[model samples]
Each structure stands twice: as C-alpha cells, then as structure tokens.
Target chain A: MKFSILVSEGPYTHQASDSAYQFAKAVLAKGHEIFRIFFYHDGVNNATRLTTPPQDDRNIVSRWSKLAEEHKLDMVVCVAAAQRRGIVDEGEAKRNGKDATNLAPGFRISGLGQLVEAGIQSDRLVTFGD
Target chain B: MTIKKFMFVNRKAPYGTVYALESLEVVLIAAAFEQDVSLAFLDDGVYQLKKGHSTKGIEMKAFEKTYGALEDYDVTKLYVDEESLAARGLTADDLCIPVETMSRAALGKMIEEQDVVLSF
Candidate 1:
C-alpha cells in the first residue's frame, strides 16, 4: 500500500518527527511505498540544516535527510510554515532577501497543495502530530 | 486524478495555538482539489466555531469570520461532536455556522468511511 505521512512537530521538543521517521522506515521495510512526507507547522523545523545534536544523541534532521536520499523520497516542507519558522531554501532566501539558506538536503519547500495532493494520491494519509 | 474523501480532524482550541488557523488554511486549499472534504470539531476544536470571537486584545486575527466563506469554497461539510459541545456548555445555536452535530460513535463511523484523515 502507498502511504503519505504528515509530520506536524519539531524535533527534540517533540517526538513526532522521530516517530514519523521510524514509521516511514518500517513502511519501507515492509515493502510499502511512501507517496510523500509532508512537514507542516513546527514540523517544518525538521528541514533546517542548522539543527545540531550532541555527539551521543540521534541526529534527527540528518536521519530524515539520509532516509529520503536512500529511498528517493519526496520530502516536502510547507512554504508558509517554513517561512514562519525561518527554514529557508536557496530560492526562498533569494526571494525574501535573506543572507543564508538553511533547508537541509532531500527536502524541498512547497505549498500546502502538495499535502492535499498527497492525500488524494496516496491510499492512506497518516499524521504524526501533537 | 481520482477524488478522495478527505477529513480534517480538529482537536485543539482556536487562538491558543496555530493549528486551528493553519488547519483552516489547508481546508481552503484542499477545496480547490474538488475532493469530498469535511471537517470534524472535537475537544477544544469546538471553540473554533463559537460565535463572537474578539481577538483585538490578543492582537490575533479573528479568523472565525473565514468560516463563513467556506460555503463559497464549496467546502461546507462541518461536523461537531455532540458530547464535546455539551461538555463545553455549547450547542449548535452557539456556533457561528450551520453544522451537523453527531455523537462520537456516529462521527467515528463517518471517519472510518474517509480515504484520508488529516488530524490537526
């Protein structure tokens, strides 16, 4: 079955991103397809390359970035939410006149339409949120 | 593209957090997809449709007015949990818009019928 996942909380402060990552991994292990992984609200924080954890702790952002890379996943960060939380890509940074871009690899900023499209395209839409 | 049954499950208060407003924004955008869209209001989410929202003191946009525009978007299926409303001392008349009030079990059946359930 194809599934679309919605992650709605930030890393460290919430377990939503971690749980979503584990679920996505399990889905892939079971040979199911992930239609898309959409980050909304505080969940957009997962796409920022600026996230840094201690040497011992699990690196949440990098984990998502790597999994997305290995699976060729479509990881989308909501543009409105990302802008509100300051998670900028090169294009967004240039358009908004910002000095730097912090969007992590394997994730792209997009509109909420991508989320609706995921819901329409996928067989199931599972949400991980607060 | 095939049309799907999309339901937005709202379980938070309106102004205390950003979920209510952001969820509304998604609903408006989802309307453009021409999918069978519905909204479920339970817990504090029932407060989102309550009448007479005054956010001037808090400096937040009183977005309750936007609910009135939902009909124009062709997204009019709004379901309020009856137990949640009764627990909050509110009734259908207290809401700013017309909605169908159903028991939680009935709502669950409706939710089970959905293709995509997006909780907020």
Candidate 2:
C-alpha cells in the first residue's frame, strides 16, 4: 500500500498528530510506501522546529525530523498555515528578512494545491484531524 | 482529476458550526456527479450520527435527518470509529441510521482504499 497523509491537527494539543505518526510507522513496517505527509491548519505546528517541550517530554518536531531522515519522507507544511502560525523555512525567513527559520530540513513549505495533487496521485489518502 | 471514490471524514460537531454542513453539501453535490461518496464520523463528529435530534429553540435547522437523504444520493458507506463511539458514550443502536463501525486500523485501511479523502 502507498499513501499520503493529511494532518489538520497540531501536536501537544491534539491526538491527530500522534495518530498520524503511529499510522506512518505502521505503514512503513507493513512494507507500504508514503508518498508525502501534508500538514494543514494547526498540523503545521508539527514542522515548527522552534517548539520546545519540557525537558522530559518528547519533542514532536525532532521526532518528525528523525523519521524523515531515516525514511527520506516529505514532511510538508502548508504555506498559509505555517505563515499564519509564524513557521517559516530558511528561504521564506531569508526572503522576508526574518531573524530566524523555524522549519526543519525534513520539512518543506507547500500549498493546498499539493494536497489536491496528493489526493490525485496517491493510492490512499488518510486524514488525521481533531 | 477524475475521482472514482470520494470519502469525507467529518471531524466537526454537526451543529453550531458551518464546516460540517458545508462539507455535507459539497459531498452531496459530488455524489450527484456520480462519484462514490462515503462519510466517517470521528471525535465530536460521533454526535452527528445520533438519532432523535431536533433544533428548534437554537433556531438552527436540523441536519441530522439528512442522513436518510444520503442514501438517496448514493452516499451509503457510513462509518463510525469504535473508539470514538465508546469515548463519546454512543452506539450504532442510538443512531437513526445503520453504520459500519470499525477500529482506527480498519478505518485506516478503508481510507487507504479510497481515491480521495477529505476531512473537515
């Protein structure tokens, strides 16, 4: 099986992100392929590398980064949502002359049309929402 | 793109918001175009499947009854997540319509088999 996941919920506050992570791990273990991971709405929070959890708690941004590094996954954060939440990549931050870039290497900023394309291209489109 | 199967994962409460209703209207119109349409309710969305719901004092139109009309639209693949139901203290018997309830794993499998999946 192959899939593209749609995430509409943020980390820490909702189970949707956790569910998506679980599903991704299960799919990969099952020998399935993931075409891309589309983050929308609050889900873009998953791509914000600046987030800092308590010292003992798990950092979702790091988790996603590690997963992408191992699997070469496309962690896509929606441009509109990222901007609305103030999550900018290096390019965006540099272009806008922002002080810093909060997005990780495994993640890329994209548009909703990519979501429509993901639905069109993938064998499966699973959505994780709150 | 030509969509063969269309699935709408309803995450919002049926009332007090326009997202769910607007989404339903979109799916209905899609079904009219001869697309395969299905609805899966999760989280607070389980409240959307309950029966005997009426909105009078709230001055909002009752959309619960519209579930019946879905069949007429050929939008018959109704599903509810088992955990979502238990957490909400709801059951299929409490619903006005019959639904195929399954675990998240099964639901994920179903979603993977669809051509397009939308959540609201």
Candidate 3:
C-alpha cells in the first residue's frame, strides 16, 4: 500500500518523532511504499543538521536522514513551520538574509500543499503527534 | 487521484500547543485538493469551537477567527462529540460555528469509514 506520514512534534521532546521513524522503517521493511513524510509544527526540527547528540545516544536526526537517503524517501518539512522554528534551507537562508543553512540532507522545505497532495495521492495518511 | 475521506481528529485545546492552528492550516490547504475532509472535535478539542475566545492576556495570536473562513475553503464538515460538550458544559449554540453533534459511538464508526485519520 502507498502510505504517507505526518509528524507534528520534534525529537527528544515528544515520542511522536520516534514513533513516526519506527513506523516508517516498519513500512519499508514490510515492502510498502511511502509516498512522503511531512514534518509540521515542531516536527520540522528533525531536519536540522546542527543537532549533535552524545556518541552513545541514538541520533534521531541522523537516523531519519540516513533512512531518507537509503530509501530515496521524500522527506518534506513545512516551509511555514520550518521558518517559524528557524529550519531554513540554502535558498531560504539567502532570501531571508540568514547566515547559513541548517536543513539536513534528504529533506526539502515545502508548503502545506504537499501534505494535502499526499492525502489525495497516497492510499493512506497517518499522523503522529502529541 | 483517489478521493479519500480525510478526517482530522482534534482532541487538544488551543494555544497550549501549536496543534490546533497547525491542524487548521492543513485543513485549509486540503480544501484545494478537493478531498472529502471532516473535522472531529472531541475531548478538549471542543473548546476550540467555543465562542468569545480571548487571547489578549495570553499574548498569542487569536486564531479563533480563522475557523470562520473554513467555509470559504469548501471544508465544512465539522462534527462535535455530544458527550464532550455536555462534560464541558457547552452546547451547540455556544460554538463559533454550526456543527453536527454525534454520539461518540457514531463518531467512532465514522472514523472507521475514513481512508486517512489524522489525530492532533
């Protein structure tokens, strides 16, 4: 089945991001197609490359980035939410006069329209949040 | 594209977190997709519809007015849980907009019929 996931919370603060990551992994393991993974609200924090966890800890950001890279996953962070939380990409950094970009690899900043498009195109849309 | 029944199940209060407003943003965008969209208000989500919301003292942007623009987006299926309303001492008349009051059981069945169930 084609599935789309919506994550609405950031890592560490809530289990929504972890649960979404696990669920996405399980779906891929089960040989299901993930149409998209949309990050909204605080969930956009998962796309920042600036996160540096302890060497012993599970780096949630890297986990998602690697999964997205391996699977060629369409990981999208809402532009509005990302801007509000300072998750700017290269283009946005230049446009908004920011010093540098922090968007992690394998994730693109997009509009909420991507989310609605996911709902229309995918067979199922699952949301995880507080 | 398939016409999916997308239901956003809101169970949280507004302002404490960004869920309510962010959920509304999705709904507004979903309108353009022309999917069958519905908004279910249960638990503390019922408070989102209460009339006369004041965010002045809270120092937050009062988005209660945004709810009124939902109709313009062609996304108007708003369902409020009857039990939740009664528990919170609110009635349909107290809400910012008109809604269909359904029993929790009925709403459960409705949820079962949805292709996508988004909880916030």
DockQ of each model vs. true complex: 0.89, 0.18, 0.79
- Model 2 chain B: worst 10 consecutive residues (lDDT sum): B17-26
Winner on DockQ (2 vs 3)? 3
Backbone clash pairs for candidate 2 read none
lDDT (Cα) of model 2: 0.83
Q: Is the docking of candidate 1 incorrect, acceptable, medium or high quality?
A: high
Candidate 2, residues A1-130, lDDT tens digits: the string is 7799988788999989989999999999999999999887778889887789999998888998999899999888878677778889878898778898888769999766566666666788888985
**Model 2 misplacement above 4 A:** A94-97, B1-114
The interface root-mean-square deviations, each candidate in sequence, come to 0.7, 4.7, 1.4
lDDT of 1 by residue, A1-130 (tens): 9999999999999998999999999999999999999999999999989888999999999999999999999999999999999999889999999999999999999999999999988888899998
lDDT of 3 by residue, B1-120 (tens): 667888989899987988899889888877778889999999999999999889999999999898888899887899999999999999999999989999999999999999778888
Give TM-scores for every candidate, taking all chains together and pairing residue i with residue i: 0.98, 0.60, 0.96
lDDT of 2 at A54: 100
Point to the candidate with the largest lDDT: 1
Please list the C-alpha lDDT of all candidates, in the order they appear: 0.95, 0.83, 0.92
Flag clash pairs in model 3.
none
TM-score of the second chain of model 3 compared to its true counterpart: 0.97
